[model samples]
Target: MNSGDLPPSRPLLVVDDDRKLCGLIRDYLAPRGWQVDMRHTGPEGLEAASTGDYEAVLLDVMMPGMDGFEVLRELRKTSTIPVLMLTAMGEEADRIVGLELGADDYLPKTFSSRELLARLRAVTRRSVRSGEAADAGKEWSAGDLTLNEETHLVTLDGGNLELTALEFAILASLLKAKGRVKSREALLEEVSDRRFDVFDRSIDVHVSQLRRKLGDDPKQPRFIHTIRGVGYKLKEPA
Candidate 1:
């Protein structure tokens, strides 16, 4: 097919030991204009991800030598590239661990190619939107929490809070809304271009992580308040 017939090529890195699965992903995504680079080992994947100019990274939770969590931890030390983790089906703990370690999103190994494509697009879109917003050089503050959009840095009570890309997005949305309660659907829409699924608890997980970093108690949160049955809102400092 001619270049005009295909969308602009998006570079993606897949880090997984399953060569067969990587090959399948490459075959499925290549025709759709994604340049898929496969790394069959955690070290190789980490090296490529650190040095390569990839729009996104697909990581598997299980790997030999270095594991996905270790690779993710090392990568987060330098880069903020969007990452979509691949976890075994029914492994809720693996999903939570990936999210806690800064993964942009996660999908089960049994996910359809269509769902994979949709999630990849959603995460990359979110990253681009975040970059654009950051370029605006905006600063937001409520109470002791401060967020610098340009730097994508957040500070609570004069101390920096290390947040993943998704966590930062969630916090930014809540900060923007301030005292207004933001429904889970609204929050998800702001951070991802995908349709909302009531069953998805990814948002909740990220929010809980953010609260922990902010030292906000879930029951009596000083910065974020759960409206229960409604959603969450950033509390105005009294």
Candidate 2:
């Protein structure tokens, strides 16, 4: 069929061993203009993700060889393509690990199709928005840390820090509000354009990753601080 006869397709890669679930997702997303490709093995998924022209990847945490975390680690070595992780329900550790490893977001395996669609849209949208903002040439600095929005480059102590897209977004959000506390809810909405869930700890995970990259000690933070019972803030250099 011609492009006009159907909605514009957004290509997505789904890396999952559950053939049944993959089929269900394909059936549900095909009509909605998502061209979903499924890979049943982690190595296969990693290969496809590296070579494919996909807007995002839907990765399952459980797989035989290499697993999703390994696949993600390998993939991030080369690509900044958005990734959404699928973890078992209530598996907080899995979710946190996935986020720390640079997955854009995570959903429980028991998620509804509607939630799946929403999460996918959120990750992709965040990716696009970040790209646009990065092209704007805006720059922000706090302490010895500097972030260049246009180039998506961050430097600490005159050295470059390799940050994932989500990490950049979270750090940029904090730098923009330097000296002002930004609640996790505010950061989540600002970075992902999604409603905040009080129970969700993905934002915290990302923040911790950012802290490590910034060489900020959580107990004696120099760049970012955790305001107990509140959220986080970029410390204004004294």
Q: Which candidate is the best by lDDT?
A: 2
Per-model TM-score, in order, reads 0.87, 0.91
lDDT of each: 0.87, 0.88
Tens-digit lDDT track of model 1 for 179-211:
899998888888876566877777788888788
- lDDT for model 2 comes to 0.88
Report the C-alpha displacement of residue 133, candidate 1, in angstroms: 3.8
What are the per-residue Cα lDDT tens digits for candidate 2 across 17-58?
999999999998898789999999999999999999999999
Which segments of model 1 are wrong by more than 4 Å? Answer: 1-7, 134-137, 158-162
Where does candidate 2 stray beyond 4 Å?
Answer: 1-7
RMSD of 1: 2.7
